[model samples]
Target: MYLKCGLLEDAEKFFGEIPLGNVVSWIAMITGYGKHGLGKEAVNSFNKMQSENIKPDAVYLAVLTACSHSGLLEESQEILLRLCCDSMVKPQVEHFSCMVDVLGRSGWVQEAKNIIECMPIRPNAGI
Candidate 1:
């Protein structure tokens, strides 16, 4: 639970000591890194997870949000797209919101709006 509360070092130690990690363990580390504003570390954790063939679910979107928080829009876009197109995870409104936020934060408000407009499914508010 160190990762859950923003303890990166302890979380890293825990992760390193474990020979095998479940989805929750990996996601916890990714989320922890993201929460602590370590966007690149979060992305690296994501890479580690994928290398282990662990499929990401909605929670991994936390990493996407972290990307936006850190102004890494391009990487956020690529990661989000990969989650859908390559990893086979379905895109939900939360993912779309992350895209919108990323684009908007990057000053591509028009692109963000267009994405919302052209979305196959309309985004419901209050996600």
Candidate 2:
């Protein structure tokens, strides 16, 4: 609710009060931060979630989207690379799309094109 209303501080405070933050709650925080263009906060929340032993699932997309929106090219690339190396989480087409968006937004059109070309899955309209 707070996040939806753009009350990030209130949202963060409430989130911190939760006794046991789950993946879903963490996703909310990350996606909320992304929606507000707070990429650093989103990344910090991602790291905190991991430190709490909450393994990321679809939340990867949220983080990627956050980085893309904030033009964090290097962070996006690092996250993509980490995703590729993590056997637990398989890189999906959506993840690739976010990476492309980040790269393209950062004026790395050729890199974006290369990423699309090397994608294991077929590019969809979303890409």
**Which candidate should be chosen as best, given TM-score against the real structure?**
2
Writing each residue's lDDT as its tens digit, candidate 1 over 38-76 gives 888888878878898877775558788778777778788
Best of the candidates, lDDT: 2
lDDT of 2 by residue, 20-124 (tens): 999899999999999999999998888888888888988899999999999999888888887888889999999999999999998999999999999998999
The alpha-carbon deviation from the true structure for residue 117 of candidate 2, after best TM-score superposition, in angstroms, is 0.2
Off by over 4 Å in 2: none
